[model samples]
Target chain A: MAEGALTAELILGTTEDVLRRYGPAKATVVDVARALGVSHGSVYRHFPTKAALREAVARRWLERWHEGLADVAHTDAPAEQRLRDWLSTLFEIKRQKVREDPELFDTFATLMRENLAVVDDHVTGLENDLAKIIADGIESGDFAPRDSKVAARAVFDATNRFHDPIYAADWKAPTIDVAFSAVVSLVVSGLSVPD
Target chain B: MAEGALTAELILGTTEDVLRRYGPAKATVVDVARALGVSHGSVYRHFPTKAALREAVARRWLERWHEGLADVAHTDAPAEQRLRDWLSTLFEIKRQKVREDPELFDTFATLMRENLAVVDDHVTGLENDLAKIIADGIESGDFAPRDSKVAARAVFDATNRFHDPIYAADWKAPTIDVAFSAVVSLVVSGLSVPD
Candidate 1:
């Protein structure tokens, strides 16, 4: 990486640490630069304002989420299996994030609310990933032809309970697995083509 | 009706009026009682605490939502058609609420956050209403037999975007009706028994 790119990467890392320590409201550009042992101007050169920095952190965090699900989408597994595993993996990733460091997860959730533009882009990115799998399924004759973009979103929204932060409280319940399975199976069966 | 029964009904109705006028935080039993020309103690006889009063109002608001869908559940239409109409009605009801008086809808959304117990009961109640239609489908052999309760919930969760408050911002989009139709058709197809 170029020298500037390295510094920008460093700024993003330190910003996460600063956010973890002081949270979004209290964390500042100065705090991030100080954590990096660099000048605030140096950080500003990379990210012009606190909002820009926060948006970058949020985008980075969400991109990491997509990273975890990408392999499931790319695997040689059948389309139905791949879609099921992709959703199950996504749900597990969100659940683990909440379980391991809920404070940080909660912080990011708050940041997500403010940075809807970032969230919107992240959502579209993941949905596009889903659309790719559906498009492949259509080509392989594993699924019926339909509007893949809209179909991908429908699949995501259908399984919202297993992954939506609002229902994170229910993730630990004994019945959640049952509910997840039902929705997954329903969607898969719904997508199957007649022989 | 007995005067006491009448009193509880009066308290509930007045509580809603006060909440709409003052929002959840500022509206109190005193305001509700004053609106009805009754003492706070009289209101307390029906609802012992502020939380209880708020719960009653929320329950009432949510029950009204169920009431709107109950007829669709009971209609002579086929199971698939009934489920489709039920979901469409719900989305319309939510859209109407959002468009007709967003302030009231937003107020209930906030109150819903604080009163998860009320929300839980309301969810279960609505899901049960859904389960009834699914059960009828199973009995009539129009649908496959499975766990009706769980299946009902999946159907409900799949179409959540049209009705969930978190996605309320998207409910007004021109494309929302298209999305709703897609998910509804998918779920209806998912629930169909193979010929």
Candidate 2:
């Protein structure tokens, strides 16, 4: 990575660490700067305000989430397995984020309503992509032609529901795979019709 | 109903109304007593403590919910139609509650983590009854046995997940019905195997 890109990643990592240890209310750019052994001016050079820093963290989280999705989307694997892999990755990311940095999780939930407008377009894009892939499967005789839109939404909603429970700072991966498999089986079999 | 039962029912209704108007933090026994035009002592006679009153309200909600499930479970109707009716009633109750008694919805959510103990047994009972009915259908060749426990839990969990957006005081029944139908269809098809 370039120098600036590397610094940004370092800043993001330190910011997440401070937030997890001290919570969003107490974690500031100064804290992140001090943690990084850098001056406040250096932190301010990259982030003008605390809110800006937090937003950057949020953006980084979103970007990483999408990257995980992209990994599954581009894989040369069966659609159903790809979908499960994607879900497992998504849940694991959420689980780890919560376990490692709970303050960010708290910040995310508190600000999700505010940030959803910015995030919705990307989320909608993902949902649409997944829907189209499922639809393709149905068309190719690999799956049944169900209401791909609704099926896609159910998968999206159910998988997201695991985030809150699985990411409790004292986290456990209990039932994550169980719930994921149940929903996946439901969707796959639900969509498959006999020839 | 007996006299004591009648009084309890009356108090439950008034308490729900008070919680609806004010939030959990503000809804107290005095407020409920005032709403019912009764002395605080009369309210106390029915519910000894504020916690007791809140528990009663939660219990009442679960009772009504299970009553709805019981209606469908005991019916001599087809398994498919019965499942559909049960899910529709579940979703519709959430829809109407979101609009009419948002306070009750709030109460349910506030107690969701804490007072869920009250509903645990009730939910277990409902799940058991549901599993038995589904198992009976499978034995009778009316439906396929595709993990009745998961299906029951899915129906239970999905109802909560899908209606959350609705219960957040959004009254979008059409979208909710679409999601609900998709989940139901998934369960139905997953369980259906060729003879």
Candidate 3:
């Protein structure tokens, strides 16, 4: 029923609030239940265990970024432009996540460390998005002939510094915008057909 | 005077043995002194604190890598070949570090996390070695006009998957070499002056 769907959505939304206030180490389902004014049993009904609850929270948080990236990947623009927009969208989403809800972002960062399988799926999904764009480019003759899968992974790894939380501290650096453009130019040029 | 020098060298060598035998968190100055069969006071004379001792060991271990990189950076060969060699050398070194003395490497990884200044200097030094090669390429017109420092950083960042310890787990992934070459080629092509 739609009521069941609303219950899960309400739990995930309240979970974010709890995590932001108490962080991963201390946040609990009871906290989420209290935030939602529901019994702890109700929270457990949605997520079987604490780990499941946390993992679902982590998955929900990550998918929001993917949704933005999906829009850019499937855009009607040229493949090259779509690739650029994809990277730009990814960078902007990460930067905004850090700036807008730093505490929640920090909580998810810890959750990511705790849940590698979730992180792996998230990375696989992102790389697949990149591959879709590169595949389009290869098909249109805009990109050099190559293994689109390998090339997509390379592009993802290449631009990791701009998006990975590991280098988040450098995002605010003064010359970062220039550096981002230079790297993007290099990537775009790399993919283009030789003159 | 040479006895004093030998004492410091002996302490450092024993510290490496101690750390390898018992990981970083458990290793201590007294343990290091005991390994060398010397008074702990003597170790303190050389390293004022446990942190200082660990910092020196980390610096010493990291410098060995830099020394190898420096040879490749300043090689009499062409800049493009040197760049290739440099990346190959880095991948091999990181692979060897994990394969050979994983415990010491693990200890240093933790030390690096604990000591940001050392990590900063090490990164700056590595980037400088990269910049030197890039500056040479720019001078010889092998590379296009741009900020050499920025380009150097991008190159370093681009090849990070092959070298950075954080991604050590993926270094052994099937098709990683293909991914590595794709990225290296992309970066090299990006840097080259168009025909």
> For model 1, what is the C-alpha lDDT against the true structure?
0.82
State the DockQ of every prediction.
0.67, 0.40, 0.57
What's the i-RMS of each model? Answer: 1.4, 2.8, 1.5
Residue A10 error, candidate 2, Å: 7.6
Query: Fraction of true contacts kept, per model?
Result: 0.65, 0.42, 0.50
TM-score-best of 1 and 3: 1
lDDT of each: 0.82, 0.67, 0.82
The local distance difference test score of model 2 is 0.67
| Model 1 chain B worst lDDT run, 10 consecutive residues | B1-10
lDDT tens digits, residue span A1-195, model 1? 233554777888888999999987899998987777767888888899999989999999888765768878888988888998889898999999988998898888878988999987877877887898998898889887488888888787777787777777778889888878888888887777855
Q: Please, what is the TM-score per model? A: 0.92, 0.77, 0.88
* Tens-digit lDDT string for candidate 2 (B1-195): 233443888989888878878877888888987887777788888788988888878887778754656677768877767766766765666666666756566667675545757867776776776676677677678776567887676556544554443246435545756666666666677666644
Model 3 lDDT tens row, B114-133: 77898889888878888888
| lDDT: worst 10-residue window of model 1 chain A | A1-10
Instruction: Assess candidate 2 and give its TM-score to the true structure.
Output: 0.77
| Cand. 3 Cα-lDDT | 0.82
After superposing candidate 1 on the true structure, give the runs of residues whose Cα lies further than 4 Å from its correct spot.
A1-6, B1-6
For candidate 1, give the lDDT of residue A155.
84
